[model samples]
Target: MTEVVHYALVIAHAIESLPLSRAKRQLLSKITDLDIAGRINGFGGCIAKNKTLGEEVGLAETTV
Candidate 1:
């Protein structure tokens, strides 16, 4: 979920020339189920990195 939010924000920012509502609608229209599944798979890597950083900083463990 966080990765999706991050991707959406980055995509929206990249198209900042467009109006906010249009940009969001356009971005959402382009997304497909496969795209979301791929991102969800990739989120494991993000979680692993976050866990490593948390360990280094002596923070509690987290999970997706």
Candidate 2:
């Protein structure tokens, strides 16, 4: 979903300091369900709010 992509890109940029393969780098990204969910909850649950993470997995209006 849009949320996942946005989060993934953000994670990727944050860690751009390290040189890494795309797949591996993605794995190392802090864009997991736990972390993303925590982020959503941390801000009073505004981001990633409408759809469940699963449902929003590949949608355009999925994330913050």
Candidate 3:
């Protein structure tokens, strides 16, 4: 999750530096917002399943 967030931030910074039209920038921003919302909703579902943050971190570490 930390790596994913960091990657998203890097992509956003890259997008901001591009010479895009206002409409294009707004469209990209909306897409980013939707993606973030989806991630948050998925995270919320994990919490609903009674998974703790420590368990999530351990799972991530093992996968790495």
lDDT of all predictions: 0.41, 0.43, 0.44
Worst ten-residue run, lDDT, model 1?
3-12
**Model 2 alpha-carbon drift over 4 Å, by segment:** 1-12, 30-34, 42-64
Report clashes for each candidate as comma-separated counts: 0, 4, 0
Between prediction 1 and prediction 3, the one with superior lDDT is 3
Task: Show pairs that collide, candidate 2.
Answer: 1-57, 1-58, 1-59, 3-63
Please provide, for model 2 over 1-64, each residue's C-alpha lDDT reduced to its tens digit, 9 standing for 90 to 100.
3544233213445645678765444443433544655554554223434344334443333331
**Whose lDDT is higher: candidate 2's or candidate 3's?**
3
Tens digits of lDDT, candidate 1, 11-57: 43444455557534344333333344446565422333445444544
Write the number of the candidate with greater TM-score, choosing between 1 and 2. 2
> TM-scores across all candidates?
0.21, 0.29, 0.44
lDDT of 1 at 27: 40
Q: In model 3, which regions exceed 4 Å deviation?
A: 1-12, 43-64
